[model samples]
Target: MSTAAVVRYWLACDFHRERRIRAVLSSFHTAGGQLQPGIVDHLAGRRINQIKPSQPNKPYSAAEWERLAQACNTMIKSANTDHRRAVEASERGMESSDASLSEERLAWIIRSSGPLAIRSLMELFPTATVETHQLVVSLRRSLFPDQDVAFAYNLLFAIRTGIVPDGIDALLTGDVTRTGPSSILLSYMKGRTGKESLVLSRAAVRVLDQWLEHSALLRGHAGDQGSQLWLGTNQRTKEGGRTIFTTPRTQYRRRVWAQRAGLIDDDGGRLQIHGGRVRATFHHLKDRSAWTGRTTIDPNHSAKVEADHYLSSHTPAQKDAIEGIIEDAQTDIRRKAAPPLVTNERDAAKFAQQFPNLVQEAELDLPAVQKLLDAEQDVFVAACASPMKSPYAPVGKLCPARPWVCLLCPLAVFTARHLPNLLGLKEYFSAQAAQLPLPQFMGVFGPYAARLDEEILPRFSTWEIAAAAGNHQTLPLTLEEQGCY
Candidate 1:
């Protein structure tokens, strides 16, 4: 694993606890020495495999291995006793509210407390699927331990569907009111919900929320990061380029519901939760994971870069803001290609002569335009709109208005491809959106979007497992990340 992969590796697991562990390690150890089995033993108890020669056909490096070590450190620490107890406590609290306790509950428990929760829940269902009678009995015994509470649930759907935080059971529970999660209401409390909190169903949102809270990010009805959802730079010229920063589907959904749930109106743009872009999220996660590919791909370098650079230090909202930028960067680029640029000096002169009066009135604008063009023949009217600059450079730097950045940006690629599908970003966005009903779209995309946050992207990433944040020692990123040294 490269530095970035190692960071993402820890993120793929218990990113929350791994954050603290990373801090500990960064503050304590400073160098990349040989594989330190003693440290691995002390942290995760997993012995390191001896370094082996790479096959002639295969190439690997020490830096990658060090990254893997950092990620492993996070996983190891998450399983540490302190983290376990914290997760267990969270599971118990969730159980207090979780209605279905058989498989659904079992899923939640196991995912949260890991093998321990599984072992405990397994005792309740000694004979596989628990009928209502068995479920009731198990529930009574499990909930009260000493006495039985008669809580009756409806007839079963699928026992396997419930329990795991991001599992189908959790999803089913989320669809209905009884198991519908109120969300892991968090406000800097740092609830340690654990990975077991992740289930496939609607409960996945709650699980993801709790997972974030566990990472020490404050969550509630509303909060803002006081940051712009864009990443772009202004060149020496008057124009500045921008890359839109978009919130993940999970965070976006949480935001929408947060308002309905009476949490907060506008997190003042700092925090936003929209539940409509899970597919895009999956693609991004896959892209990052593909880099590490440990035992699989090249050991994802991009993910590790993200983990190293923007994994934890920034507020959850800030991190999301950055990820949003990255997500946008990977998005498909689309725009009205400039009308054939003013190809020649003769055409430019003719256009000037035709608009001679308008030109005189807008001298300031003309100078800016002339400055942008290397010569009079350089400009051309494209798309029946204003004359556009060369396509080679990002549109933002070419155009001055901040909103214009969307017209020509690599980050906007995904948005460009999907905007037609989404009523929000489509042409005549407000008008088209007004003509269409939203419930159905929200239903399918809503949950998916909720599933794409850092807490869930791992499902699509290289890890072949759910990913988390905060799992590396060094701030992993290229020199350009503003927050790091």
Candidate 2:
């Protein structure tokens, strides 16, 4: 069959919801003529129609089974190749970085199942609780399935076993460099392609233990800077720490670590210990006493996306927001935008320091690039934000009770087409939620701190976070003694 035909057959597998499948594939109008129509996750042979009506497509004959297997393999291989191509394209976009998410690793993620996948996940996560486990599994299904389903499953397995598989940190960094095939764990399984690597690690078990005990080190920041750039997800490592992470989900973990570390101040402001990205955490730190870092959490996250039905902040606005985000970092990313320095981080940093400031001094403070990021966020916030409410509706605020239209939106099209991507977005949304308004659950919990009235930050405030280490002390916020969000 043609590539287009193969794509259509692949979609008609029995595992999919018919309505959902249609919604997802609706955009691929080109495939209409070439494909079979059915649910997803089915592997079938040529003349697959002979299978039971309700069952997944089947291999009618022995020869057909082999053909089906070949098709499945081909389909999977094509996805892996496509993913690598995407990765390569991204690398080229980023100036041709030498690394790529290798094929061996992608294969491992897709084919492996059971506890073996769990063992591989532990190196990055110490202990995967039920919630975390469910999260990992969901993320696995949503991650690049054609590429890293097992890798995702391994992450889920780690959660179940409380193991932290090695290289998980790399995954968080969007790195998919696969380690070589395993030997020790799978020695017992005969046919020995020696591919059965578990997702957890001995070190991860220890980390999980430490994490559970809240024993891992937690540092507070005393100051932070974030006036000209978006607070990056990964803060600089303390001294020689090997892992650097900034994905919204990792930021949540960092915030949890901070809470355990006792880093956030009495008020919602994050403390900068020496000069790390504590300020980075502040981007999402809405409440005092919990600078849990910025995240794009699930559920309401699309509210930002859904809000797109509301407004467009424009490119200039985007550029300004990025400018503020960068100013806080005062990095040279901006200078890199010019054709001359566009590819160099150092040059980027230099330009970040120079151009915008020059523009500010010259009084044309509304620089173009700053507006770009602002526009981006505004576009996103608007697009993703929910139009769940309207003046036409009858409610105090937009009722959260209305049905969400996630199933049919353009965003949903991708979510349905790629479960792992949806899962990633869910995790990202969850992380953002971790930083949102912590409800009292109807007078069940105490406030993180008293309300801030003496000091009303009319708008967002930026403080300079010098490069210190971790563990900064927080200034107490004396509220009206009465509490509020």
Candidate 3:
């Protein structure tokens, strides 16, 4: 098989081919760099293909990703500090005996502990020369800092945004554009949508920005490294403008960092960095773009290819999300899923009476909908004039009670789209009530609690509610989200 095809097959099955091959050959030993079983005859009748690949599962959780990032960053800070102090001591005209660090100790520190341990060793023995400490610190920092942080940031970005490892290294300053909105644009190779403009979330943007600053500092000493995104002690050639990490070193560094951060599985195997990130990107897009029927994470890949290679794993949330989507799709299949174009009052009333469960998808010239909104119903907006106090009150008149009280009020116009938002409000109030004293809970959530129980949820079937939640982004923003809180 071709190398890329082999990789895809391994990822599809979540297996390690090399390890499986080793297991198959455990009984054989090599002599003079050849298998002892006489390879020609052994392969003639061997059914070597019978060995099945083992299925593996090792994706990092959000908490685990954060831990690895923090761990990597902490080492980076310590390593940089050690370099600065040693350089400073050299500049101060201190003799070699005044500040000492041995090559053996430096090697051990770099291999096992961080810069702090090296500093502790230096302090333990004040007999070595300053020149020795300076040289050791400089060499260690040069080799370690760039690889340490570059791998961490690259892996984290890949996990969150689904940037391929090659794509991460291919990034340039101009590629990180913020044309509008909170997200920054990330242009990468082989885009499905003609060099598609991908976006990094606000959080990912912050980390990338930090890495950019550090990369600039490293560039001061990174001779001939060119403008490649990841810079180490390695030099770049003028023709290709590539660093040593352009090959397999990036993956090697990723393994090192993953091991250091305790991200290895209980089986002592590291997760598939590229495949894991791609899977995460698939699910994140599914979650944020639920209103859209399809996820567009890998636009270049066919749907069948995506299912086979990328979207092979599932989390509990993902399964629930898929089930919700299926239920919504089934509802769309059953109900008259199109809007009734009834501009006049008579037809509007007729449509409303016949399909009380359905809502309009297209805008009509009807005065009520026009007065309430000029655009499509992405979210439910209301002019509240309740006697109860509510988070929604600041949008209009005050409410004397909780927000769900507006559901029962005549001034509040609700569609099936409001179902998910209402259900979310119900859960929020329930949780709040759980922590309060009885009387306080009653005072806080008593009416709203009863309203959700006695009035709201029973009005529609659970399937109908689920369908409405997926109805083209119809849920309204909470008061806090709308700047009311």
Candidate 4:
């Protein structure tokens, strides 16, 4: 059994143990044999936390996958070319009896009279010099390849569609439903997932078409015997026996094909081709193509599985990119969590004592603090410590941020002097709240509005708020502000 099955079996055993414990506890209670409260709780809550095993198979490297794909393509192309030529030559009415034992005559005989028994080929060409086995093998290969060719089609299909080998093995002619001129909806049974369907890509569709055409002659000859989509002649048939078209179900045949292809691993050893690893490689390449600013996990996988199996095994560049994203997120959280600097006092010494780090970070001296208090460095809504040093804009550039952005900015300082403008901005927010939907207003302006009311305004006295409200002017909003709402 697989590792997953073993884990599940142990978990079931744990459950059965817990059930038996419950039964024993109930019998004890009936007999008036009291148990300790802690023991009873522990028995009732007993569970086995099974740690799932990590997937052992890793995807092929990009270069390795490309090499395998190119090899498959070459074999497929050669097979198709030979099949087409054989069919065209047969159409020219080339008589097999008129020619001697040659490649062209063998092709004509196979295409015209179906795959012949070796005894029949000997009867037709009685004086042939070549060995009977060699002749039959060469003719069958040119027309439709041996059962081992199924491996090439299966591998290419898995590489293109990310389907498991079991799914490809289970395919039938009826399972393919054409949705468009160049697309098909292929339905197959996965051993683990049961029945599933996928709309194949154009490239996958092309590969399927080629396989179907290449196997069509054998499929026709086999009739009902060739129900499986992957049909090829059995190469090991007894001498003088008819060619047998059947599905290639054995892994030995696939391994033989891999050996012929000379696939190699990173360590210069023979590549052990696993269906699951092929699927993983497809998903990996897909993820690389679809990657935006963040990691995009496959929807078919659980978040934990995606992270543990795929995301954990990254290249150095990918690791660096992920680290950068994490650092940016942590920095943003810290910046947003810092308390706003609001004070009514004009004493620069007291301000410096209250926010020594901020004063040093922004390089604000006593004269600069005094200037800030006197409204010499005022923005639309707050007194900016440094107008040209906004975090939202480049250093030494005037801030191009919206007025509401100042409410949460680290350099912004609120005092009684800026209260009238603050009250006016609050009024503007209220107007916007009325005009916009609740969700939209919350998404667009909720954080700034909350910071202004809950963190900045509450610091001032009630009389000061009243005085500011009385002196506040109702400034008209710009079209830029009104347009978005």
Candidate 5:
């Protein structure tokens, strides 16, 4: 057996493991000097597809997402209020001396001096009353949260920006720059995509500003340690009891915050708040079809990744709407692929015999088909069998389709009489192709021009085409059509 066959047999039931093993072997092959063909070479054209898990980490439901957002917002708001009160009390002549210890006094001390003043306050009043010590500890906990208050700010920012967790964690003070009055340019590093930047929305800017204010006191005390945009306190230290200036790292602390906030998922269990899930929820709730007339949601990501990871995962209603759009596109493709119903003869003598399926499909009898061939139902270019029953317009109204639209319309019939107009349309298409860009010309007139040149005109005899070409003139056209030339 080949190397690929042997590897496949060895890991037949564990495709995920097989993919990892293959990746390792591929890396080894590259590191080595390619001494032999090896396993990676044998598995080159084949894909070891892993089975998707039945219950993947799907985007959170709307209710769960809203709860998460509200919880984060509440925590941030409370921190902001506490920070504001502390600043205000400090300005009102509250002192950190041993005169009398109160919450406002402790707040003033922490605000004036750094968080380190809490230790000094305890030392200054060793035999102080129980209420004084309690007040000092409570004030410290409120101002510099030991549980990493940065989590709330970081989660809220991620929820709004849809940035990956690594990008958020790697952010520094210098990464945030004010680009406009209401917007900020945030630069961060992503492991996979390297350095990236985004112009934050007004809402995101507000959240970031609140966080900066909330952590401003600690940052001033921290100096070099506060460079990392997020700062909290580490209460687990045995020496100083609670050390200030920390970053959000552990998931356990975030879970504690979630529990404190009383957040619950759809299953009524404790909400598992992770940065990845938060980012996914942000994208899931965003309008994927909305064009901002600028850049994409995440320009660093490829279209395949965007579709596979985010766009493909949607609620039932979204899936239904997307399916409807896909069905319409498929129907249009099938209609365009159908050959144009053009005939050289001017009468319906052989219309039924030549195109019996079309005749039956349109439910056209001999007299109705004859009327189409005799130009009685003539439009600008072709004779429409039933103008009132056109698919391009309302059922009871005339088709307001463009002249070239008849080339692909199922209800249209072409005969020798339309040759002069058809030749004129071909010239019009040529002029359009010259003026418009390649992609635009291909998108707008490619199908119609292709049908006319390759299908409709080819059915006519060379002598008949020559005769029609001689009679071809500047045909009467609408303002829209005349403007194109």
Candidate 6:
């Protein structure tokens, strides 16, 4: 639809509650037809009943949601005023038949002088929320107190589930059922494409029950055993009679709330809360559940659509969360693998200098003279003096191989001074291996541990082994306590 038509539809529909002429007329306005019945009929002669696809909505940030909720409070305050209620009542034709609820009335106002002027204002801002004690004591309640509970629930449900305004109108009493823990069944699905049943969260179920109770108290009927869960009174209809409350009015009030909240974006896309909320819900699910490769919030969506579009558009935080999961998995694998070995002082010094971040040094001395040493809890092991490049070291970078891989490499050299670190490495790997997946445990830890136990330990002297055992019991614990764990 053209932008003008979209703007006109909300303006015209917001004022009238007629189901017959206004319903078709509202469709014409949204579909870009002239306000005149003859012109609208001419434009939609053949394709009168065709449904148009909705525009994609952008998701709101956490700040935007908070602002929207706050705005709802502001609107409630303004809605209670004599002037505001008069305007709202006139718009709904609750005033005397002689009273004017036309552009002329709005023209006298400051912000909106006419229909076009109000439309322009709305094009810039959209309103969207609720109050404590489960009610909004505003002009709406003053004018239509019977519908207050139902109206509040409509906004609450939409904010929570991202359901379209029209979808909410389709909801029935039978749709709500307690199926299981943390699950409330929603049976009256929105459209043909909607899920047969939706399992609502426990929190949602609690609110739903409250709304039902409020409805029963006000209307003097049990909402739990009725045809419609949402029942509200209205002042105007095409027939100039009372009508059932619907989404169009709810939508208009929400926009007013949003505009007051100052949550509307510059582009005016969020003026319509449904699409924006739906997008936000989708993004939240993607961030939380994408790693399992089964992130589906709205059950109506196909897997292909979810994977192709939603998963590919992860926010920066979502990307970081996914990477964190992968890192955890990789760490688990390395823990099960074998521990590295330093058989002599030369190798120990070389490994220490090559991987300074991994090895804690007591002093910064030249590697050529090999004076730097790895400090234990209260002792220092003299550095190894190996001459050749580490066999497992990566090109132009520190070693990427796991510690256990260092034990199996032929280039490895070690001595008594290296005993403490070597024992700690073995202990760390043995503890991690148990937590890793079986494939990673077998592939990395089993073979490396065997090599460290067999070939490397035999080369160490009795005194050196004793020192390593002592360092293993104390040195690693010291590093952990110092926040280097």
Tens digits of per-residue lDDT, candidate 6, 181-300, equal 546878756565765666775656765765654444223332332466676644223343434443333556556545544566545555455544644664575476546556576777
Give one digit per residue, the lDDT tens place, for model 4 in 12-116. 675555466557765885688776665555445644543456776688998889988987888887777867876675655374455555666666666656666
Over 1-485, each residue of candidate 1 has an lDDT whose tens digit, in order, gives 24455545554656456656655655555565443444443345331232356433211123332332233234323323333453454466566766554444543443443222223445655655536434433332232111000000100111112232132212321332323445332111112553333223443344343333332211111123212111111111121322111122233334443343232213232222221122223334435754534332224455666666655468888878888888655542222221112222323355456445434533425444343233332211111122333234454345432222333321121111122222222222233235446775444233323322222222233432212122212312245532321
Q: After superposition, how far is residue 114 of candidate 5 from its true place, in Å?
A: 2.9
For model 5 the TM-score comes to 0.51
lDDT of each: 0.32, 0.30, 0.51, 0.77, 0.77, 0.50
lDDT tens per residue, model 5, 193-248: 89999999888999898888788777887877788888887654455565664557
Misplaced by over 4 Å in model 2 are 1-61, 96-143, 146-485
**What does the lDDT read for residue 16 in candidate 3?**
48
Q: Which portions of model 5 miss their true places by more than 4 Å?
A: 1-57, 93-98, 116-121, 240-242, 288-485
Over 4 Å off, model 3: 1-131, 138-144, 178-183, 191-194, 234-249, 266-272, 275-282, 285-485
Q: How many residue pairs clash in each candidate?
A: 75, 118, 11, 0, 0, 30
- Of the candidates numbered 5 and 6, which has the greater TM-score value? 5
For all predictions, the C-alpha RMSD in Å is 31.1, 36.3, 24.3, 15.1, 14.4, 22.3
TM-score of each: 0.14, 0.13, 0.35, 0.50, 0.51, 0.33
**Residue-level error in angstroms, candidate 1, position 102:** 30
Q: Show the colliding residue pairs in model 5.
A: none
Candidate 2 C-alpha lDDT tens digits along 1-485? 34456447645664345344444545454456444443222222233323345533221233322332243344434434544553344334345333333333332332232112433443334544666555444333322231122222222223323222322322221111224332112111113242233433443344232221221011111012211111121222233342212122243443443343344443445521211122122222223335334434444555566456443554887878877877845433432222211111113234346444433432333343343223331211112122232222353454222111222221111101122222333333344346545563213212101111111111112221112112222312236312421
Better of 2 and 3 by lDDT: 3
Residue 364 of model 1, lDDT score: 25
Model 3's C-alpha root-mean-square deviation from the true structure amounts to: 24.3
Q: Per lDDT, what order, best first?
A: 4, 5, 3, 6, 1, 2
